[model samples]
Target: MTASAEYLIALAGNPNCGKTTLFNAITGARQHVGNYPGITVEKKEGVHLFNGLKLRLVDLPGTYSLTAYSMEELVARDFLALERPQLVINIVDASNLERNLYLTIQILELGIPVVLALNMVDAAASRGIEIDAEELSRRLQIPVIPTVARSGTGKLELLEKTAEVAAENRSWKPLHISYGADIDPVLDQMETDIAGSDFLLDFYPARWIALKYLEADEQVINKGAEVNPELSSRLEALADHVAEHLQKTLETYPEAIIADHRYGFISAVLKAGVVHNSQRSDRLYLSDQLDQVLTNRFFGPLIMLVILYAVYKATFDYSALPVEWLNAGFTTLSAWMQTIIPPGLLQSLIVSGIIDGVGGVLSFIPLILFMFFAIAFLEDTGYLARVAYMLDRVFRTFGLHGSSVMAYIVSGGIAGGCAVPGVMATRTLRSPRERLATLLTAPFMNCGAKLPVFAMLIAAFFPARHAQMMFLLTIFSWIAALSMARIIRWTILRGPSTPFLLELPPYRMPTLKGLLIHTWERTWQYIRKAGTIILALSILFWALMTFPLLPDARKSQFEADRQQILSQLPEDTRTSLMQPGIAQDGLTREIAKASQRIRAIDRAESEATLQHSYAGRIGMALETLTQWSGFEWRTNVALLAGFAAKELIISTLGTAYSLGGADLDAGMSLSRRLASDPQWNRLRAFSLIVFIMLYAPCLATVTCIAKESGAVKWALFSLAFNTTAAYLISAAIYQGGLWMGIGG
Candidate 1:
């Protein structure tokens, strides 16, 4: 069907009213998801074809009321009014008809065509309640269709009814809620003023905006003021005058009373057409029992921890073999390329730069896939909402809404995937303070891109037994985040916690297609970033370590010095130093004497080369400040480069060790290398690991923090606080270890 001629159906409902389920059932996998124009709120559109007709369905955000206290509500209201959809498919939960119908009544008053899709019919039936759809439709002067959306029952009928209503341009009769007489006159005048505007008349019925303005909805007031200043001022004055007449404050207007009127009307209709049996169903009792345990105060935190550990284990442990295979394949490919290509800059660029950089990212694919699958399973089983409900009380203590917990959990998997969505999730939060606090701290959670760095570090330092250490460190990062969140909430973000009101939906098996899509999307993001930013940085790091030809100069000087010393040692000794094989000469004896002197100079030259390089200079500068924490210049340089991205720590160490060509099996891991160095003992290694764990987040994380928080101040604070903490902890580890005789 052509776009203009296609039927448009908009899904509108209150929060937790089964609207999302209905949308999912109707659209299935044939949907495009994005954000609303100029806002972060999700927008989902899908095309469904049934009975030779095409329908373009739009799913609006769940909103309690259209008064615009939050962006979600405002977006829902604005889209309905401005878009002027052909029909609004109002999905109201039958079990909670009173609260849900309030939104339905408001939509009816907008004078737009609406078809009531009485969703969750099964739930209502299980509650021993029955509603006569025909009788209810007759009373409301609109069509009402019963639906169990999850089971796809009545979906076809709902669509047919929607098409019929939209095609005929059916008008829904206005239902009036009786606000007290004291406010009626002001509403009437405000309505008249609103009617004068062509823009208001084209979308929303004049009466709706009038009621909203009388209620002092900032969104309506701002829009009205922008459109017509005079009208807005008059409306404000009318609201004030009405408040004076009623002897009440303007902002504390009778919203609850008006709400009660709508509920009263709903009750009257229900009494006429709805019936309820005496007994409650088994399903309801079972669901309630499960909710109690899952959301219980004492067991909730423990449950959350267990679930998180399971996710980590499944993602890291189960996928270890596949990740290893990928790493081995890349190594084999790099080795093969070395033989086929001439040994030059191009070979180095392709093998060490491109292969290493891209392979490093791809190696984490197993973990990324598993993480997404685990999240999908939790979401599908409805455990995610339960998790939110359970954590509400605890999260509130830190000025974070329970809903913020979801963002943190998702971000913890991959920090850079989409901070927009992570921040957007905070809309479920009721308090502005909690939302802002969550937005600030969300980026600190390690994302998928950081996984490789962790893997590399753990593998290098604790190779034989690293998985458990990696898991423990992962848990430690979260603990640190929670502690920091508490500090911020109490010291900087002092405020009352928002009320936790969440709905726990029934569990269902997740769709494999959806799971795969989500997993691939996140995995692709990690791969792309590594290929671009990480790859470029790796090449630049290689250059910094290799350039200016100091090693070559040292080798040339050593050869010349050895030749001169050997020449004086006699013909046999000179022949031995010049020959390729040690066995061919008394040559071997002469060469051994010369090797000792050359070794000392080579060590000195290696130190000088490092001190003269760009990275070395920066390291030395940082060393002056960080020496107390047992950080040498090389460690300082590694830490500095690590800020670009934590995964670079591995590459930095590899470069420092000059082992890019060394076999993984043969080369000493970073930990072992450090352990062997007399200057760096066990205490230093432990201190360094602790410092890495608590250091300032990588550059990508900092960017996400700034974007999500909507300011540079919070991002800078995260960096400053984390870096300071790392330094202090590292210093303590060093000094404490010495004091305790763990290290000298």
Candidate 2:
């Protein structure tokens, strides 16, 4: 393409157009997902090798048009205009050609080399519709390849055509379409002034900029004003004059006329023997027939609930044994480390700080894996979109836009997502108040970080009803988020509800390869976070719970008690009992009795030392207030660490218990130890789950909320409001449960 070995190609299309499926097919596992610079919009890049040439493919955010109405559109437009990828594979739905072509027309107007991917040809064929790709391509003067991305049909041909286009090394030639006599004169004058002055020409073509102004695109108008106020003012006046004249004459805005013309052009092209429909007009397609029942007002919500419960039940049932296996493996590893390392700071650091702490979080990978698999399955099947559609009715009642459903889902409304992306996803909302309300309440959803904590507590306290507990938690999170959104909307961020339009994609069976790739991508993110952030925080919290050792007098008292017990025993028995793992082996009755007593002393000494440490003291200080919610000093420390990252709750608790000598025998899981703790019970565990689900989001999420909302005050409000509400509600539940003698 450019005499270099690597060519950059951008894959872009409307959402639900199989763009991602095609990208995955091309790149397989060679992909990286990250945020665009200075924005949280996800940037996906992958390498595809063809004909001994490495082509780098960037999967741009899915958007309906190049107009900057949402963040996705902005990112896609900026990448194309600024980065100028060598070629673009514009994926359009073959079954919905007219609607999808709107974006294609906009892309072509940008003057970049484009190859139209008429994706979902099989779906179109299933509906008795046929597309003449050569006819369409000839009309548009570009390659049009029919593809079924889900099954890799026509994939090779699409890539080859894209490579040929890139090799052409063509200069950009902006497409021109007439918008009738009313606006064409003004548009031409604006374009001439724009080009003669080279105004904002570095990033956009002259005619394209003129069209943007006539459309009243906010981002373009603002940029034009910044670049040259006087010229921008003249152009704006011309655009306004044309807009007013068109509005008065035709009762339509410039953008409306522009869209009508674009559609007009597409219609003319298709009418020229480009598309053929064999089905009767009255016949309903398969997707519409399915939607009749799946999106029914009465049956849709019920079916969604049933489906969600099934997902939870399957995940828990399938993951339980693997979770136990991981727990056993970590416990064995911890014990092995203890046996190899002598009893000292080194042993404690490895056994308690690193092993016990990180292992607690790691043991839940099976659950995370299964849950992610379920989410990916639902997403790939397009059922999640229906969930959002059904929930929109309920969301509207709670002052949330239907678009908010996606934000919540991405935040784990279904229960395996994250708040950062959920917060970032709010960029799609047009209403400022609705967006703010959504982002503020989004963290209440059970994100992946909170998943380990919930899984551990449920296993320890509600073992018999894993799926039911998770389902109820999902229900509770939705209730909490919606109720809070209503309150916030009616109070500080007051606003009337705006309309929401959602496009439901046709359901396609997910390929095992795609599902596994998605599952691993999400699960690996969870595991990676555990290994990095959670590991570091675990070590830090461990040090806080381990340092400032007991005073010399207190240490001497415990040492004296140990020696006293040892002195009374026979020298051989004392020596044998002192060695690790020997006390559990053959021993006389008297020696066994003495060993138990000494072990009790060690537990007491360790407890005393923990109480004297920094984290313990902090927890103790908060106990007076938090005890009302059934949390003790140890639980308080764990909750404190949860603010940094929710996964740390399990790890911090593990470290705290390991340091406090909570009867951690080799191969005993953290849940078992927690279950056996005197201070923990069903009521307390449920209360803790409630608090963790509703409390302040992790620091990363708070930072994201701030960045997305463009204000630190809202972030602070999220933290303060969430924590306060969580404390009050959890305290009420705990106190009420105790009054009723329920699991007290």
Candidate 2, number of clashes: 0
For model 2, what is the C-alpha lDDT against the true structure? 0.90
Best by TM-score: 2
Q: Candidate 1's residue-wise lDDT over 1-744, tens digit each?
A: 344567778999976566777887777778776778867567889988766567899999888777676677889888878887888999988877777887888887777688999987887776676878888888887899999876778998998898777778665445566676666676776777677655356656777777776677787778778888887888788876765655564344545546666677777777854646557455455557777777678887687777777676666777778877787787677667766877566765666556654565666677667776777667656787787777667677666777787877666622223334565566566666677677656655665545565665555455555546655665665666677778778888778776666667655455565556556545665666667777788778766755554567665876687666756676655554443223423435545766445444545555666566777778888987798788888778778878887667655654554322222212233434454556866577667776876778777667666765678997798788889877987898888888899753
lDDT of 2 at 271: 96
* Per-residue accuracy of model 2 over 298-388 as CA lDDT, tens digit each: 9988998999999999999999999998888888899898878878778888888988999999888999999999999899889989988
Q: How big is the positional error of residue 726 in model 2, measured in Å on the Cα after superposition?
A: 0.8
Residue 587 C-alpha lDDT in model 1 = 33
Candidate 1: C-alpha RMSD after superposition: 5.8
